[model samples]
Target: MTFENAVLKLVSGQINRVSQPATLRTEEKAVAGEAASQTPFSEEALFEYHLYTLENPATLKNNQAKQISLMSADSVPIEKKLIYDSSRNEINSIFHQFQSV
Candidate 1:
């Protein structure tokens, strides 16, 4: 898959880095909801983790950080959960789940 005008962000164990801004272009299409007579076509933006090869080597200096974007999605469905274990402790944990279409 090729992405145009796509921004990338690198995330590792405790360190995060932002890659250079690029362009992304896709030919993928999505079908809209049922209409009275005709069906309309809409552009859907799909974001996924992908490996990208850099044209040139990038270097980072100490204490220097760069900002990069990983992915962007619209109208994403999310579920939030709160759990408490009386046997374990009195601490409550919060969990968030994101569903991708």
Candidate 2:
């Protein structure tokens, strides 16, 4: 199988002819503290999700791992967020946010 310039979030697999969820590897980088510096008074902020696309067709093999390069941009905008989830033991989580353009 091969994919070219595809934004695939979920992929399917077959196990004993039964359809199942397939695993995919992804790499992402975001710059934090950029948005926080702009809006310090906001309690919650929205950020963009980075979309990665292949420059060429990537071939996939069964039970074999392959590394491919996605799109690379210089100085991509990002936001840093601190989330407090009450449902998950009241522990705070820090994550970089990205919005898809």
Candidate 2 yields a Cα-based lDDT of: 0.44
Give the Cα-based TM-score of candidate 1 against the true structure: 0.31
Instruction: Judge candidate 1 against the unseen true structure and give its global Cα lDDT, from 0 to 1.
Output: 0.42
lDDT of 2 by residue, 1-101 (tens): 54444433322233364665554223331222443334323232224333233334445655557754322444556789878887886749888765533
Candidates in order have lDDT scores of 0.42, 0.44
TM-score of each: 0.31, 0.25
Residues 1-101 of candidate 1: C-alpha lDDT, one tens digit per residue: 33444333332332354975443223111211212113122222335433333323345555656443232345756789889889988658897765434
13: Cα error in model 1, Å: 16
Measured by lDDT, the strongest candidate is: 2
